[model samples]
Each structure stands twice: as C-alpha cells, then as structure tokens.
Target: MSLSFASSPFSVVCSEVSFAWPDGTTVLDGLDAAFGTGRTGLIGVNGSGKSTLLALIAGELSPASGTVGVAGEIGYLPQNLPLGTARTVSDLLGISATRSALHAIERGEATEENFTAVGEDWDVEERARAELDRLGLDGLGLDRTVATLSGGEAVMVGLAAQLLARPDVLLLDEPTNNLDLDARRRLYEAVSSWPGVLIVVSHDRELLDLVDEIADLREGGVRSFGGNLSAYEELLAVEREAAERAVRVAGSDMRRQKRELEEAHVKLARRVRYGDKMYEQKREPKVIMQERKRQAQVSAGKHRLMHEDRLSDARERLSEAEEAVRADAEIRVRLPATEVPAGRTVLTVNGLPAQQPASLEELIVRGPERIALTGPNGSGKTTFLRSLLGEGPEGLQVKIGVEGVRYLPQRLDVLDDRLSVVDNVRAFAPSASVNTVRAGLARFLFRGRRAEQPAGTLSGGERFRAVLAALMLAEPAPQLLMLDEPTNNLDMASARRLSEALEAYQGALIVVSHDVPFLRTIGITRWLHLDRDTGLTEIEPM
Candidate 1:
C-alpha cells in the first residue's frame, strides 16, 4: 500500500478526463494532464473546479469521460473534516491493539497466533505519538477526546494523521487555511522536503510561490504553467493585455467596414438617380441602364461581405476581450462602519487558559485598536478567541465591554444556508428595506439576481461575502470586530480587499488569521502571542 517506495517518478496521470455533477453541471472538460514528483500549486477562483479536480485525482470521484490513472498511493486531506464526538486522536489513528486486531479479524486474515504476536505491544501507538509530536502536538494526550479540541488543534491532528501515511501523492485542500504563521511555516517545510508529488489547492499566494509550478483551473479546464506565483500572475496580465489589444483592433476594423459600406451605397444611389434621369430623357439609354446595374451590384457585394465576413470575427474578438477583463477584475468587498467612542477597552483577559486544565495568562485588548493574534497550530489561537467571546471559562477572568461586538467565526457561522443572500442580510438589519439590503450585498459583488440565490448554492468566497454583508448591515455597527480565520476560503484579491476594508474601518479590530502578509497589511498595532509552554498570553506593541 506504500507507493512511496515504488520506482515510478510520475504518481498521477490523466488523459482526456472530464467530469460532471449529478445535476449535469460540467465541472471539468477534457482535462488532459500528467503530474510527476514535484510540488504543484492549484489556483482558481471559487467554483473554478479546483476542489472537484482534486477529488477526481484522489479517486474520491470518477470522471464522466476518459480516465484517471494513479500510479501510486494517494493521501487526501479534505477541506471539511468530520471528527466524531466520541473519537479520540488515538482512536482515529487505530493505534490500539484492540482496534488493529478487530481490523485484522474483519479482513479474515488474522489467526490466533498472529493476534497474540501483535498483542498489547503495538508500535502503532508510539508511531502515532511521534507523528503528533512532529506536527507540534506534543504533550497532548492521545486519549483526549476530539470534541474538546479547538478548531486549529483538530485540523493539525487531521493533517498529522494523513502525513503519517507517507503517501506517494499528497493532495491537500486549503491545508493552511486555519493555521497560524508558525504552523504554516512548519507545513511549508514539510511539503518542501516531501519526495513525491504534491498537488495543493490553496488561495495562499506565499504557499503557491513555494511550488515548482502552478496549475490554473478556469472555465472548466486546467492550464499548467511552469513558474512561481509571480510569474504566473505576470503571464495572466500579459494575456489580458493582448486580448484587449485584439478587441480594439477588431472594433476599429468593423467601424471602417461600416463607413466603406455606407459610402458605397450613397455612390450607388447617386449613379442610379443620374441613370434614371438620362433614361427618362431617352438619351444614352443602354449605357445608363448598364451603369446603374453595375453600381447596384458593387454596393450589394460590399454589404454582403461586411455582414458575412467582418462581423463574425469582430464579435468573437469582443467576447474574448470581455471575458479577459472579467477574469482580471479583482473581487470587491465593502465593509460598513459607524462612529465609535475612542479609547475604550473591548476585551481584557487576565490569567486565561486556552487548553483544558491549562492556563493562559494576561491577554488584553483596547477599543479601536488593531491586534493580530498569532501562534503555531494547537497553540491556542481559536481558543483565545473563544475565551474572549465568553465561550470558555477556566483559569481566567475575562471581561468584555458593553459596546456592540461582532464576531465572524472561522467557519462562517453567521451565514444562514437556507435563506437567500438578500434575506440573510435583511435578517441582520430588518429595518433596512429589501432594496437597501440588495445594494449592500452588491457592494460585496453579489449583484442583482445573484443576491436572490440561496446561500447554500454560493461558493466558499461568496458565502464569506454574504456573511460579511450581514455583519455590515447590523445597526449601530459593531465597535469591536473579532474575526477568527477570516481569510480561510477567500481568494488572494478578496483577501486583500478585506484587509483594505479592515484597515479603513474606524472600529476596533481583533483578527486571528494564518495569513501573515494579510495581518501585516492590515496594520496590526499590537501582537498577541499565546505560549503553549507555560499556558500564558503575551501582548506587545508592533
């Protein structure tokens, strides 16, 4: 089952691969490709077919046409993890002898002698522990229930479990979405040294730059380019410019043809009038008739050529240019703001504990201040947010001011899946009319009929925008905004837009995100580090 030791360098191959959903939506069309032993970043907008392609390559979904050939074992880490309430990390790993024995017995391949030989002296438990440690989950008890783990901790554990398989092809979907700076660095380091092929679906530009190539999924197909992130961006820019130039040229040519055709018709009309006058006078009759006929034929020929030949290419060029411009347009997000009293404390924590039975000490925040909460995964980023939100009460006395606070949970809990985007925004601010809600949603790029679509049908980025729209609609807008992993599913342009919006906000901002550059861009005035060693929180001016 371990394909890493195989002789083949190329781990995955796809030929004329095409896939469609049950509803007949074409997700991929004629995607012919081969990937070998190197890290390749997969970049695309939401619903651009990145996730679907990853699933197809991982054998989780079959292609509707052609074939997907896997030369080696594949390990896939799904975007959404399902960790049952009763399962512990150790239980999930199948490290215990009892579970291993059960698996063997179920296979009908284990005898009493083999079972006894394995016994209670299983190395799987130790190996699991070692892997967890390597993932920076050291000292965390294996028997600790998964339900109690924070979101970041759970993600790290899942990643550790997959990495332990040592697969020949590793397919990761937004692997660093919820991780902090240190954890992202660790992940990057791990992938950099991985011997086999890595196909990663991520919106992280820094992570994409680390890859050997970037595969852009767009318009139901994939385009592979051998370059880093910057190079790929430059190529896209150049292509867009060329498309624009073609469109301009086509427009000019169409205009010239129209003028020439009009001139030809005018000349033909004059000649016919002169011929009719000469014929009426019974002077030069045959010559006038022939001249009129020739003029009519010439005008007709010019009109036919203009309609039949020149127009089609012109229209095609215009369409291509429009598509290119659309592709280049950055995602737009507009965050509403309100005036708030300056210099008020929004959150204050003294002796806070991020982990169960452990303590985090001295975390504090003031009003109208931008702060970045960062640390390694499982080092209490989300836990710290929860503690501030009054979700956890252990070794800390947390105090939140009476000011209006808005918290955007990491998983987009603000979104109502059953309602339309407009309805969701209206729910947050009922006094605002439906038209007002629609306008606000439009600011976030959900325009016209798109605002009427169900929230469940929207892609990840759209869903995030919907949630943000709801937040913006709230009256007496929140003076304190706490966002936990806000940029997880957002594309690069959207992330930058969100950062810009945050920077422009007049209210206090407390952001917990894995994107280091984003955090830096938002102008974090302070830094909060949650230390896992001593279960303490430290804050310093940036």
Candidate 2:
C-alpha cells in the first residue's frame, strides 16, 4: 500500500519548540520539526515527549518557547479518549447538530435558524454512518452511548469521529493501543489511505509499518527517518552497533591516555631524581644546576598538564559514547516454584456464557499450556477472563484444579494504590521477608528504591510490572496465571520486558492480548478464540 498523502494543502511545523509540565519536568526543549503531508509514525520510549509533541501540534497545549505553525484544521485523537456515558456516537462525530437541524426542517419547521444550522452539507448522518462502517463499527449507529462500547470499540469510535471531521492535519496518539487485531487492520487501512498530513504516536508494530516515515522523539528532540518502522529499526540497529563500537574504541583510548599520563608522571619523577643526584654529586656548577632544575620542573608541569587535559577529553568522549549505547534493563523472572507438571490439570471451565456472543460449554487447561485468547471487541473475551477469575459478570462456572491461581486484570487493579510495590508483593507473599520480596521485585525490574514507590505513582509500564510481581511472587506461587490484555497501555520496551519475564514462567499461562507478535514471542502453545456464534473454541496457534 502506498503510504504517501497529498502535499501542499496541509502542513505542520515546529521551530525551536520548548515545553515543560507544571511540575517542571521538561518534555520538549528546542525541538524543531516539520510535516508536509504524509503519514508520520511518532515513536520513542514512553515519556519521551511523543504525545506532548502531538498535543502541541494539535493546539491542545502551547509551547513554552518557539512556535508551532499549522496551515490547516487539525483533528486529534488523544491517548486517553475522553469518555462519558451520556455522550452518544453522533455527538462524538460532530454531526448531531446538523442531524438535528435537518430533522427539524424535515418536520415542516423551515426556520432560518434550522436551515442555517444544516448549511450546505445535509448528509451528515450518512457520512457519520459511513465513517463508522469503514472503521469496523458497521452495526453501531450514531445514537449508541459510549458507555456501551468495549475499550477497543471505544477507540475505534474515537477514530471514526476524527475521520468524519475530514481535517487536513490529523494527530493520533496511541491509536491502536486498545484495538483488537481486526480493528487494528481497519485502522491501518485508514491510516495508509489518508490523503492529508497524519501523525500517529503508537507502539503498534503493524500500524507503524504502514507509515510513510517515522519521527523519533528522544532527549527532547525529534529525528525523522524515511520509511516505516521496520526500516527505522534496521537503521537503529546499525546506529546502535556503530555506537557500541565507538564506545569500545573510546574506552580503549581512555585507558591508553591514562597509561601515557602515568608514564609521563614516572618519567618526570626519574628526571627529578636525576637532577637531585646531579646536584648532590655537583656534576655541574651550582647556578647551572639551579637553572636546569627550574627548567626541568616547568617542563614536567607542562607535560603533566597536557596529559591530564588529553585524559579528560578522552574520558568525556568515552562518556558520550557510552550514553549513545542504550542500556535499558530487561525483566528476568525466575519462578521455578510456580512450575506445573506436564500431566497436571490446571483449570476447567463448565458452561461459561456471557449475555450474548459467547459461550463455553466445556474447557480444560492442562499442564503448563500457554493459551492466548483472541477475539474481536465485544466478543466477551474480557468478560470470559474475568468470569474465569471469579471477578464479575455472573453465570459462569470454572474449576481450578491447581492450588494457586492469579489473574492480572486489564486495569491492573490487583495492586493497592496506597501500598508500595514491595508492600503489595508482600501482601501476597506475607511469609516472604522484606529483603526477599525486594530481591524478587528486582527480577521484575523494580530494584531497590523503585520497589518502594507507591503503586499510585507508577507509570503504566511500571504499574504492569508491579502487578505482575505481585501476582507471581505470591506465597502459594501461582500455577495458573491469567492476564487480560496485559500488553495494553505498555510501550514497546515494556511489552518486550513483559514477554521476557514470561519466559521464566513454567506455569499455565492464559493471556488475552491483541498483540499477536507479543503472544508469538511468549510461546503460546494454544489459541482459544471467542466467537460470536460458535462460542469459545480452541484453535491452532496463530
């Protein structure tokens, strides 16, 4: 698919832009960028100002310094979609007013006010429905309340709203975060076919791969790379390799400089000894000896200062080189105690059914089987997962053959907000001493003081890790671990960290995630899909 969009009619540019949060945390500083139409995938580690930049471009926030210039109307879909139960899809699509006006005129009230409201475009409802249908919300009418939609459905609705606006410049932040696989493909198609300037901040690999270019936000600056995510990754791999090589070379140079500095000091000391010995032996005249000693001291001082300066320069270069090499820590969990034997039965489901579109007459999870639950939004995947965990949504029965069971809900409500990460884990494993809990948390990348941070204060990725640690480190050692949409709201690095942590899990794993690539990485042995008509069915691994 062609990623190119029309140029000249749309443009967005930022020159020397600087911004900071109210708490003085710098987000963007002197960042300069431009978008002259086409899809731009905004990517970076979480908290790297990608979303902040999008906000700036969309005029949601002003830059503290510099300017953000735009030549066309902008439509923005923020990361956390503003949702209200009272709000309807029509209101969200910005067509309710027109629809009402047209309806009033059709009811024989041809008032000038209603006519003016209708304006020239009288097919607002049709357009709205068409947009929704194009985005996989075909059956969802404009009057449907936002509260009735699932997380994925809500996200798609928000996207549909933006598309209906038909703005020249579009900004989407983490657009595919809560999207199911099919919904993601629909969104990707929309993005790929966009005819205006489009900037999307997301960690969705599939969505990013459809972009024309990538804008990497890092260290309060922006770096644009041509082509999509895979291309950018290839370029980044090369850059990292070069950076590591530079670090090694600089380190070697630093050591050599230090050695030279030491040798110079030794030579200076020998010269001093020779001069003192010559003076004691009176090899030359007393005045000549004093002058010679004075010259030797000056020479030694100059040599020492030069070497010290060179060494300092080498050290600075080495530090810069090291900084260029990414050293993000990966979670390395080890939970041998949670292992389930190959022949053991972990869980059994008996006649689990949702209100509609889902039913599970019978199911059995055997051994350390890792099952990935896949389904479209509103297919009752989350509902089934919650029912399996005995959380909510009645009319479901499940038997836990295993002694230990732990479920990490999509919201990650398992951790108490007031408690520290260590304390939360300790709550689950009360028998574990503070030191032991802290040590276990370190494996989840919450080492030392990070473990002491209150759960309420953690970032999304940190919160997931904290919840995972609490679930895995419980006293009974969870043999049947269930995660509902665990990869949602996580950055690429955090998702990878999670996958790595799951590598050490020898227990039965049931993860409901839209990230198919992530499931593949974690070694999903079975795929259970919730279908609308057929209900819950086991399918071959995707």
Q: What's the lDDT for all of these models?
A: 0.75, 0.82
Clashes of each: 2, 0
Which pairs, if any, clash in model 2? none
The best candidate by lDDT is: 2
- Per-residue lDDT tens digits of candidate 2, residues 6-116? 454338778899997554556678999887679999887755677778888888888899988887688999866767789888777778889889999999999999999
Structure candidate 1, residue pairs in collision: 352-360, 353-360
List the candidate 1 regions with Cα displacement exceeding 4 Å: 1-10, 13-33, 61-67, 94-122, 251-283, 290-294, 297-312, 328-330, 341-367, 394-404, 416-426, 430-462, 474-476, 532-542
lDDT of 1 by residue, 119-159 (tens): 75456567777877887778878889988776767777777
Residue 446 local lDDT, model 1 = 75
Q: Estimate each model's TM-score.
A: 0.80, 0.85
